[model samples]
Target: MNELVLPNDTNALNNLMGGRLLHWMDIAASISAQKHCNRIAATASVDNVSFKQPIKLGDVVTIKAKVSRTFHSSLEVRLVVWTENISTGAKAKSNEAFYTFVSLDENGKVMRIPELIPETEEEMQLFDGALRRRQLRLILAGKMKPDDATELKALFFPEI
Candidate 1:
């Protein structure tokens, strides 16, 4: 997804507003999730988002998103945002985020989706780390006990 950072998308400092950027990222991540499952997906959660660089008004912002991993009914989408200078045609990464989406049926019930088979080395790394990240998220949300996070526990206590 590509967006022009117009005045409406910027704050008083003439940089893109964080909220507006988040909205754009959600749309982009949702599109990737929907395309993967071929079903309507609802955002379940969004990880912390940090802007690495200020995107000024008139800059072109490009967002690239892909499914990092999939659980039974939910998938994680990784998104990278870049800002381009129109005149110089230079582009630099500005932000990155992870979004979780749950596929839904017409009745709005959660539906199972196909799994992701990561082929590349980068993909394999992300796929392997997804479980630890998910466990941490669940633990932080109070949905799972820290002791139950086997993958995460191993990181801190390798003997166990």
Candidate 2:
């Protein structure tokens, strides 16, 4: 997704507001998920979004998102945010985020999705990283107990 920065998105300090940036990120993420699933997908969660740079007004914002990992009924989407200064045309990395999306059927229940096909080594690496990140998020959110965490660690990080 690409957007031209406007004055309305700026705050009193003339910097872009975090809320607006997040809203855009969500939109882009959802679109990417839908494109991957080829079906209706809902935003399940967002984890560990960090803004590394400040975006000022008149900076062109570009968001790139892709499916990082897929589970039985969910997928993880990783997004990278970038900004380009209109005057200087210099591009800078702004932020990155990981989001979970759950696919739904006509009745709005969780549905199974096709198996992910990773064509490149980088895609395989992304899948591994996203799985690790998802497990970390689950542990932090209390979704995984200590035993469960230990089991996952054994499965994914035995070398550690």
Q: By TM-score, how accurate is candidate 2? A: 0.91
Single out the weakest 10-residue window by summed lDDT for candidate 2.
145-154
- Report the error of model 1 at residue 7, Å: 0.8
Number of the predicted model whose lDDT against the real structure is largest: 1
Listing every candidate in turn, what is its Cα RMSD in Å to the true structure after a full C-alpha superposition? 0.8, 2.1
Each prediction's whole-model lDDT (CA): 0.95, 0.86
What are the TM-scores, per candidate, against the unseen true structure? 0.97, 0.91
The count of residue-pair clashes in candidate 1 stands at: 0
Candidate 2 collision pairs? none
Model 1 local distance difference test score: 0.95
Off by over 4 Å in 2: 150-160
